[model samples]
Target: MGKANDVQFERARPRIWDRLYPYLSILPALIIIALFTVYPFVYAVRISFFQNLLTKPRSHPFIGLQNYEEVISSYYFRSALTVTALYAIAVVLGVLIFGLGVAMLLNSNIRLANGLKIIILLPWAIPTVVAGLMWKWILNSDFGILSGILYSFGLISSYIPFLANPTLAKISLVMAHIWKEGPLAAIFFLAGLQLIPKELYEAAKIDGGGGWRLFRNITLPLLRPIILIVIVYETMTAILVFDLIYVMTGGGPADSTALLSWFAYAEIFKSLNLGHGVALAIIIALITLVLILIYLRLLKTEEINV
Candidate 1:
């Protein structure tokens, strides 16, 4: 009887090991993720409740929601919110228009379509910081390639300071953002366009549907999912934009381009107030989360309606 029990126990041990093998295989990755992602997020949240100032680093008193209150009540917060909203709206709209246009053009059997398709994604391939630097150089007040081209054509009496004036700076920033982000959106749209059945378009044409009619009815409806995705993604990107501002505008020319993320950076490094920065960052994250949730709810309703 004892020998039989020992053999049964050994068999059960293998079964238990098999059950835990999958979890053990992924344990290392779980540990790494916790250490990097989870730990930092928790730490940031904790830091936001303290008085973490470089000037008084020796005393980090518990401040509760004071950091959040001070940051929210400031004038800079209002300005940053406004700028961020405008920038997000403009960039999302511009990217959608530009992307849809490019995608439609690529889908058509136009001359050099293949070549254009290959070249169009180059901007998206470049790093955001590098793209911003490139744009900065192109729009430089003096001796910029764009200014040189315009001067050569006698379009302006003098080279325009694209980054100096508040309005021009905002426009230039928007243009740069569209150029950098439009390519991915175009690719997304193109993929959606390709998935659409040719038969649908053919039938619409047979039913006397012209280009605009077919697009308004068939193309738009079919591409609704892709459009929503692009909107959400572009909105997030626009809200969190920092590298471009850092490289191109530095939130300058009278703070016309100082976005919320830029203010967060300023609070942390420039103002040397870690608690304020963390709180602002948390606010930004919450704003993004709320927007995403709203988008997801709309998407669900859309799916249900369809």
Candidate 2:
């Protein structure tokens, strides 16, 4: 009886192991995420309490809230915040407006719709670094195809450095973002447009609703959910945008285009202050967190409506 019981217990142990094996396999992924993603975030938050930077790492010491204070006190930070706000607002609005327009246009009876979609998606599919480099060349003051065209059309006195001037720098960044992100937003809007029941449009027509009126009343209302999602998504992208600015201006022309992300990047890699870099990163993450909370609220409202 004792021998039989021991064999039964051994068999049960293997069954338990087999049942738990899949979850055990996922432990490595969890560890990687924790180490790379979660741990860095946690460390950044801790680092934000001190005054640290790249130049003098050896003399660094803990000064609670000093870095945050410095960030809030710095004129450079304020200017970057203002610039970033304007950039984000412009891109979000443009992407939504122009994207919806394109989506509506393509939703109609058009030949080669699939081909058009593939073409439009090309920009979004392009890697961000490559897009930035491509645009840098396009906006180059000398020997660029765009510059030559503009010169031929008598649009300017001479080569205009789009990435050099602060206003134009911001505009160039916005244009780059629009080119890359607008089509993606349009695709989302197009999906939403397709989901809308045609019967509603037919009913509106029966009631003598015209195109403008029908769109204002029906289409906009239906598209509200998707619009909210796109706004949140685009805003986050704009907030953390680094590639274009890095490639085009390098936050140059006297740091006029230095965004928060660029600032953090410089601190981390350029300046080699790991702790302070981590701190700046934490602040950025907090900003992102706030934005995410706002998105969650909007999502809840959407669910209530549904």
Candidate 3:
């Protein structure tokens, strides 16, 4: 009877341990995330309601909604919001178009497709600042490679000040952003493209489908989830764009490139208004969260349809 009882206890212990194993396995990751992401977000939220100026670091007072009010009522807030919206739209469009084009090209059996697969990721692998600077050099009005090429080809009379003009600066920023960020989208799109069964394409072709028809009816429908993902990801990235504007344009040329993130940096560092900066940051965070939630609903709808 005693030996039988010992074996029964041991069996029960194993079952109990197995029941808890999943949660135990995930515990360490939960701890780390709580320590890093959760703590920082909570702290930022706390800081946003205070009067924490860098010039008076020791005098952080709870000002409640004052910080929020001031930041919202600022002159540049509206301008920054408008610029961020336009910039995000341009960037998301440019990245989607460029990435989809590249992914389609790489998916093809063209002669240059293999070489492009290797080279397409180079810009993405490099740092954002480095990519921005490289583009800056290429677009420099004085002695820029692009300027010189255009001049040599008689496409222009002389060097073009790309970064000094408001419209051109915005365009250059978008181009640089596409160069740096489009590769990841291309890779995502390529993955989706590869996952599409070849039989579908073959069947569509047998039904007298042309290239455009096959793509429109079969490829596009299959790639809808991926396109949705790319749209959401690129929209967030474009809204938070900062490094390229910093390295290439500095939000100059009449503040044509002043994104929300750039505006936050200016508030914190330039204006020495930590409270205002954090308030603006909170607003940006909330806006992004809303966008993400909307996208998630769209994703769910897509899944349901599928």
Top-lDDT structure, candidate number: 1
Query: What's the number of clashes in each of the models?
Result: 0, 0, 0
Prediction 3 global C-alpha lDDT? 0.91
Tell me the tens digit of each residue's lDDT in model 3 across 241-268: 8888899999998788888899899999
How much is 99 displaced in model 2, in angstroms?
2.0
Pull out the clashing pairs in model 1.
Answer: none
Question: Using alpha carbons, what is the TM-score of model 1?
Answer: 0.93
State which candidate has the highest TM-score: 1
Candidate closer to the true structure by lDDT (higher is better), 2 or 3: 3
Model 2 per-residue lDDT tens digits across residues 152-258: 89997688888878888778888988999999999999999999999999999999999999899999989988999899999999989998888888987787778
Judged by TM-score relative to the true structure, which candidate is superior, 1 or 3? Answer: 1
Q: What is the TM-score of each candidate against the true structure?
A: 0.93, 0.87, 0.91
| Model 2 residue-pair collision total | 0
Candidate order by lDDT, decreasing, is 1, 3, 2
